[model samples]
Target: MGTIRKGANGGFSGKAGSVIGASWKSIDYIRGLSKKSNKPATEEQLIQQARFYTIAKFIMPIAPFVQVGFSQINANTMTPTNAALQANIKTAVVGTYPNFVLDYAKVQISQGSLQPGGTVKAEVATGMLMISWTNKAIAIQNGQLDDLVYILLYHPELDEFLTAPEPPTRGLGTVDIELPEHFLGGKGQLWLFFADRKNKRISRTNYLGELDLV
Candidate 1:
């Protein structure tokens, strides 16, 4: 604790003590030593931090890809050769099925893809959910050919999983899976997996974590 001394002019100043004193805007204040506590975060803060951790895990690996894709799109104003790069970045930062027709096009100009993608944005369509990716086949030219893509759909409400064919390919591919009519208004997760065909090794996976069909 510090002491406050009254000046001869009827003002106040801090005396030399354990606390440091200063004046701001004509107000005198004391700065005390900081105390260290072994307090744990509350349950709510822990939950929120967990959510942030999850989001960070999802976006970290793909940040560079998104950044490059966004720059290419901005420079050319043409369709990016790696469209999935932009889509994946957008889905990670924002949600799924973002309105590319609206503010999404302006995302690069305004916010940019600097941060981890936002929450998952669910897409609502009639028949099929189309998942696509590129450059997997090119990896084979570098003697890394054993690459496979796995698409998984999980119905949490029903505790069921709908697995798409795990196809092995060289280059770009698209997987279109027909959803059941009953799942039209349901919620679930759509996960994308890239793995090695030989050891069933997974390189990386993108989780479109929470999907709501309408």
Candidate 2:
């Protein structure tokens, strides 16, 4: 852009002839309009775009969880969602470009020093879903009793997700969550993890297995 002194016509604020003019910091400037490119994509570029499209389609819906999951990764240049996608695309995605498939079992939501509880169980009681782990006293002794539980249920077929409100602590051993009306006739997958009371620590996510929600 070239700076210009105000003329008899004053400074222009929009397009005039082949150039555009605007004022910044009380100084007037004029720059030529940029040209648009209509270049066509090459075969290789299309394939790469397909792979990115496949991963992005799945990741966008659960981006909120992805941010928390990849918060600890040491990548300063990219967002947490991008970090999670890069990490998962290598191992969790299967098949070729046009048919890329994401393996839910291989997906890692949260990674941290905290360890997961053993022998997790999922059961449907009336309209409530109950999740439990073994030996709550063990966690209390280790100073993780107050770690809050976070549960996520995803219905792949419906492309929907459900989360618990005001989850209980790890010391409770088992938590009962009310199932939504939409989840009554449908089935979905379950995953759970523990976040410390202060929310500074997160345990590796545990896949609590798929359930026939009722």
lDDT of each: 0.46, 0.74
Model 2 ranges with Cα > 4 A deviation: 1-39, 42-44, 135-143
In TM-score terms, candidate 1 sits at 0.38
Error of 1 at 135 (Å): 2.5
Q: Model 2 TM-score? A: 0.72
RMSD of 2: 7.8
- In the range 1-214, model 2's lDDT, one tens digit per residue, is 4334466567767777789988764666788899886998887887777777766777778887766766666545567788777877666677776777767777766667766666788888678988888555564435477777778888877888887788677778888888877778777788877777765677788887778877
* lDDT score for residue 194 of model 2: 72
Best TM-score among the predictions, by candidate number: 2
Give stretches of model 1 more than 4 Å off.
Answer: 1-124, 136-146, 166-170
